[model samples]
Target chain A: MPLFLRGVALPFNKGQAPDADVLAVSATGPVYIPLAKEEADAPTLCVEENSTVAAGQVLCHVDRLPVFSTIAGKFIGTTMVNHPLYGSLLCAVIKPTRSKRVETLPPVEEPDTDTIIEAAAQACIYDELDGIPLADKLRLWRMAENDQAALRSILVADATENDIYGSSAWCILKEQAQEALYGLQMAARALRFSRYHITTMLPRNRRRALKRLIGRENVFTTGDEYPVTVYDDSRDDVFCIGIQACAALSAALQQGQKHTHTILTVAGDGVPASRNVRVPFGMDLEEVLQACGADPEATVILGDAMTGVPCQNTHFPLLPGITTVLVMQSHAVRTPQPCIGCGRCATVCHAGLLPYEIVRRLENMHYERLRYLSTTSCDGCGACSYVCPAGRDVATQVLNANETRGTIFLNWGGVENE
Target chain B: MNNITAPHIRTEAASRHLTRDVLLTTLPLCIFSAVTYGVRPVLIVLFSILSAIVSECVCCLFRRQSMQVIRDGSAAVTGALIGLVMSPMVDYWVPMLGAAFAIIVVKAPFGGYGRNVFNPAAAGIAVLSYCFPQRMFTYPIASSMNPLPTGMSVGDEVVTSLSLAAQLRADATPSITRMQLILGDFAGPIGATATLLLVACAVYLICRGTISCWTVVPYFATCALVAWLFPAAGVSRMYGVLAQVCAGYVLFTGVFLINDTVTTPRFWFARLLYGVSAGVLVMLLQRIGRVECGCCFAILLLNSIAPIMDRWSWYVWRYVTRFLRIRQEVKAHE
Candidate 1:
């Protein structure tokens, strides 16, 4: 039996991601290919300052991986953009030549591992498995293959949504079950992994539907927990991927299609309808919101409500990694209250770390004590912050401790030794 | 743009909502006390709540914080609890001072609201009990013809009144019957005396997810077990447990004060241990000396050790799981 992990049952409105229709937003404005903000060194640009480019053409290269444009456009220029993972980066701007034109490459015959990997790299398929390029994933898989005994199993986390209002992944699996299944098969066959697990927290009805698509023996139901969005983290060898990414892989292998379009679930109280729409990559979020009839005053968040980062600039392009866009009425920002020692944070912590104690240690700069407590175990799930009655930003504090643990220790400079 | 952290939204019940729910949950006890004692209790409650709110506002002004912090309803809860724990016979200034002290001194000085290490109301009651023992200990007796209004002054109409704790400590046989003690006919704290009503409100609070059963059940169980095993004044185990629980603020403190979200442990096992320790301490303090409202003092003492309880709970949980793993391995080998 698959064990049910310790997590708090959250009471929020659960809405299925709209999967019935795919509404495409026309690419009217300039498209931006944002470079990773963490890199101190600027990425090498493939196209020069005033070059015209076709859709699916390489705009730049970061760490030797190509960054492709989703629309046929003229190389307008570079502009500073607030990158999601990092703070800010210079984005290569491309003004779309045509709204509907999507460039494609010839599909390789007899789709093999290397061919698929190369096509994925050329097509700019970013797999969220490690939040790395597909090419990197292929390299990692190849390295893992050298020592097959080290491989435990592969976990396909088909648990469609991370938050109460999330359901896009479920919708994708429901609509394109065959493609997703084939993609999973191809991944397993390529890696030559015998043991694999498919997990979902979908209701019985949807589970039944998914079972028909991916055999019942492969499916294991999980409880309704927020942290289950990330598969069981205990098994370090388990290579987990979203069902949509799996389907995208199969599509890239079978058809000669590049990763040009992405399906986004625009839901919450701010929009007129909760929709699952197929939008071309590099299309502005504002255009998608206008199409969805989102409220002008509503706050637009790029991802689920629980752990989604608030979009400071909605004018930014929606990339392939962008999945859920929540447009909801802005609630009053709760001033962080004093820690009540309620222990609710500890209870809801999926990482099993005492968030309150760890945060206290972090705030006081007690690096050694935090290390003793294993503060780095935190998965940055934000479950602790979500359940805190005192409205403390618990996950952020824990995340700070994990990220800054090394810097703090280095800065200590043998003070304790004295 | 409201550029907050990753969690764009929060749990529906914020600290304000929770405090409001706690205030609402105490309604039944308030109503029962008003009917049984009189309007004096209500006035005392009103005065305390008003003073607490004013003191909080004043503190907010002094601290240069947004006056909006008072809107979280914590000061109101502190005020209401202070009033409930006061004797109706005492002057109105007693509750007013208690509420102000609870908020401005015990709560605000420690850093407002959730930062306070002690239960504000309990601390207020403790200070009052120490300073004005005579006034704080006095209570109005209810008669058959006219149950004296709770807020009314102590006069000839309320002639014969005995403080339950004083009477219990004096001798084995109490002036009031066990049933009367259960029904709260004698002089005691306004809300604390209403045993049945307080219990009902506690159940309601637990059901509403405002409080946890882990805190209450283990605390009560521990109290009952201790009182039963070591009877007070040669009384039977059951009767002794009833006397200990009913005479003082044991149940009321267990349900509200110890379970105060700001001061208690969060883990279920830690909470259980916290409850057990608090119950044991309450009984130990009661046996040692004449501490008026021993449970309140016990709670304050135990609140300081809550983090320790949490740490120990973590260690024990790891050990237990490890032991279970070893046992399973041994079984498989056999």
Candidate 2:
């Protein structure tokens, strides 16, 4: 091109600030303190009764939940402290509500271990007789639970179970199922199998317990022509138990259910003591921090000591994407060093481009030549930068060299940190 | 509202950067061309580049668009390519005029860059070869061999043509040493003569990731395909492909010129078509017709029909897809 053409400049990235009012100075610290084991012995009282706090500044924060501020303040703290998405609220938060005043539990809705185990055992017996994935067994169990709901659910969808269960390894197990009994009454059936080849599972022990309790052969584990006995008198109750067992069993077999409520194990040497406590999903980290008594300002929120995203704020919704939220002092700022021409970029590039030569091109302002070298083909897997002996931000540099577009969102020009 | 980018970087893959890399890749050639022929060719390239940019700018202005042509590095490339095809020792003003004619008439008037029909450089060379044969080949080329200490020197004539080597084969003269060609001990184009220099630039371009070896490999392979099948070098047919490739700019131009994404065919078969035809052209021009300047002319001619070939092939593909769909529907009905 003739020397007259000029290039347009793109806007640079501007990160967020601290708790110094959004309209005013953007504050940038997260001063806080981790609640220690020794703190249990101290006369625990509200630390921040009412005080405006800076980013990471303590507003009666602690590692555990169930605590309030002795001083007066608003909170600005990260929530991920070892446990992601939720907090493990061990102690009382609302000053231990009077147990006598609050009456009644939420109705023993799902049943305890023994009854569940009994129902679960029945479902397993049914499974062994048919050798099907839990979903199929649940379908039959649900039909037996409420015949009206079953007809509605099945008739609303005209496709057959075979069609739904595509040809997969699971189909092999499906073939072992007893033939479908599609009359006014489904037939009682069981799969034929030689018993006890693989021994000492739950069936052996549960059978012994059930026999002792019911006096008759109450357990249905054996392939005795019919895995389930049709008891006319107790039909509804039996169906209920079957449905309960099926639901519980299906939940267990699910492959991809994520952790909603989790136990935060705060037991690192860096932490005061190792202890596990349950926390709800999406609980604010400031609430847990106030409970733990850590200075949010000094604590650096690390998702993990290894691979973690560093950010200044914890007000963002907690996501399962993070693993750990370590609280430590921030690392010092670093400047990039010039490439020593060590040829490390060349050695590590998977596409096999001489990236050092590429750097030379960039240095020489030959910006247009990068493509023929397969620079666009770079996957940005970070292997090159991760292994770079010079520790140059090689990955970041490569990323900077390429142009790609992503979704856009609102940025109310200079959003003041709250 | 807000735009965030991880440095939304443009690929050199665009005509812009591809054009720039082509310029950079051909820099040694340009310097060699200028030095050998004197700065007349350089002046011509400079004028054509300016004219192309100006014409593109004028079009962009009339269309109320930003002039992207210059930033894309295409106009400069067209100019340089024209400069390469022209003779070294022409009077300074002729190249400049040819460049103006090439850019204004061949490139910009037809919507510029990717939109142009004919190869701008080739058209310019064609025009000049007809208009001024004296300037293009005044000095007997069989006598320009002594290497200048710096740039391109025009002293007493020397047997400098690489075509001389091709022509030498019939006369049973000892073939020009491969080392001399590769290392550039002999003389030819300011840029294209040194097989090694071209290789180094090609390697740099390939490593830069602008061009793929797919086009490069296949183009030469197609050229060699015919050569290989009929042993022209008196060796085994397999070795004929290598011999044909190693000789002259067949390898360099096959990898670079015929492989140009914008002008060249895109689909492998279409590329094969381009390659194979170009191969035939090169063979006929060199061995049969005995045209000294075959590579550039073959490429320019083939480039003219590349789009039509691609479109025709795509039409065939679409027809097949539609036919299959209809057949499936008929079977279902039955």
Candidate 3:
């Protein structure tokens, strides 16, 4: 029998104070929009410098997710800034006209799956939870629509936080319950599927309210383990969307506007107070921190602290998929001690591979030994890093090996290539 | 890039911290030994630790590796365990030379801490036992009196002629009570004299999760079972098992030495099997009167065979599962 996964229970500040309030934070400064500059598939820029653009207008195109201007503004040249998703790229700096002139889409009546996919592609409704574009997800679902087993369940994941310190996914599910339900209902209608599940990490007191709003049978409560709440049963079958994504879908059908505002959580040590706030996308993160009453001396980070990319500075604008704005005091660097083979990293790994042994094999360049050890099964969850007593970066080492070796080490079962 | 690596947060317990915990757990054993067998054991510990560190530093210099590798505290652990298992009445050079040899020959040449195929302390003790078979078997009488240094021992009250193993070999259970044997009144290695104190230390290590029950539990269980099933000549099964467990450093060696993380297999079942194999080997060696504390030799031998053990178990399991799958598919076709 497969066992329930064991993970490190993070010491989250589970106070009622932060969970009780919802603060409205507005971003007013120039929004810096990042353009992709990867090797072969960089985003093609559409709008140039000094060009005036309206809200929800397409700024650039990268695959199906068209980059939209969240605010109506004049394109005031480009600035080089570190993006949370793309690395260091040139960002289109826009001084918001601050006018209510959003270029809107016409609401579709009795929309089918194709209409929904087309609308999502035009609106740039990405699956803000896993950073996968909604168009891409829809395209996959569209291809597999004939095979009934291809799609199993549409999970509206609200339980993203393993600790009490992370995102506002659960908060959006609770406060905007109808909107979230509407989003799921629209997707179900578009795709013609019945099964739906909502997962949450809210306290017991708050659970009853959420269950009453979205039926108890459809809701499941879990601890702070991240991937558990996201893909509880099967990784391939289950397609998950955050409460923000669901609410965005609802808005696209009802309000006739493309993806604009984002609901994000601002919390951590250096912040004065932790609160869930809804701010327009492309708003400067520094302006958001000011509105949320964050201390200026505090270091600002975007996304989850465990797996999230650290922002070089707060000059960049908040994007659609960016969920949490973690403000905390800078931690001092600690020199890592050697691996003592305690096997704690292996014990806590969600993936069944031994991370410490893999790292040891890598250090010695024992490629054949690593291949047998299933080094490819590592999902880069950082659980090994969390439990390592020797302070070794087990995840980074495994990720490095996987990236460098590619498929050669991973194809053990003779199934991956096919 | 940040100066600090990824995984910005880490567990509170480090390798150095765990090694320090193991060293700290040995304190009670050390104190009990000092009160029973004088400061000779303590002196041996000090000498072994200093030599181990010096040898490791020299090895790092010779390899052109950074000298910063000495800060992990594994050397201190190996040295202390070697000291704890040594004969208190043996020459002072025994522990010092043994510890240095273990570090340079066994540990450092294999590329340091986690890379060694054998437990350093166990290998050291095994080598010492082979070199000076007569001095290695000598045991100091348990008392508050300070032990005379080796080569100047003359007083009858200070030392004993035959240890518990020697007594067991002659088919004559020592005249001391079982209670005396358990409570450190009998003659043995300094730290091995007190069964109660060593057990208490093992319980602490297990509770703190520094030591695992997978290794220590199966070891004692296997040792007891083997002794009970096949008692030695001229002793009841009960007495044989109790004597086997209580006599000669088996308890200390099982808890501390055999359970070394690097020397054992990764899987829990594999670890249990390793312990069981060591227990069987030790009992077999003891029955034939080959070694005094057979656990040291058994653990070192088992450590060398651990990789083979892992490979054998994996292949067996894979073939069994594949057979089951094939039979099920055949049944389904029928």
What's the TM-score of every candidate structure? 0.82, 0.43, 0.83
lDDT of 2 by residue, A1-418 (tens): 1111111111211111110111111112232222333434333434333334321122232332222221122433323233322332122122211121211112223433333233333222123112232223334444333234332222110011111001111111122111111100111111111110110112245336434543332223322111012222211222211211122233322321112222222212233322223333334555544444445664434343222334455543333223234444433322233343323344345444445445545555566655544467565544445434334556555654544211111123343433
Model 2 lDDT, residue B204, Cα: 76
lDDT of each residue in B48-145, candidate 2, tens digit only = 56765665566667667666446766666666665655445445556656666777787767666655667776666567766775565433242233
lDDT of all the models against the reference? 0.75, 0.42, 0.73
Winner on TM-score between 2 and 3 is 3
Given the true complex, what DockQ would model 1 score? 0.49
Per-candidate interface DockQ score: 0.49, 0.03, 0.39
Q: Which residue pairs in candidate 3 collide? A: A162-A224
User: How would you encode candidate 1's per-residue C-alpha lDDT over A266-303 as one tens digit per residue?
Assistant: 88899877888777676778888988899988888887
Assess the local accuracy of residue B5 in candidate 3 as a C-alpha lDDT between 0 and 100. 43
Q: Report how far residue A387 has shifted in candidate 1, in Å.
A: 3.5
Consecutive 10-residue window with the lowest summed lDDT within model 2 chain A: A156-165
Across residues A1-418, which tens digit of lDDT does each residue of candidate 3 receive?
Answer: 1243756666666344335656665546787666655334446668877888988888887664678777788888766766656667766777877676788888877777778777767777767777676767666654345545435545454555664366477677667777778777667655556656676767788789888877887677766553353345443346666767777777787777788777778887777777778787767788888887888887666666666556557776677677777777787655566676676665567655667667877887777676666667777777788777777788899987776553554557666666
Worst 10-residue lDDT window, candidate 3 chain A: A227-236
Interface C-alpha root-mean-square deviation, candidates in order:
2.0, 14.1, 1.9
Higher-lDDT candidate of 1 and 2: 1
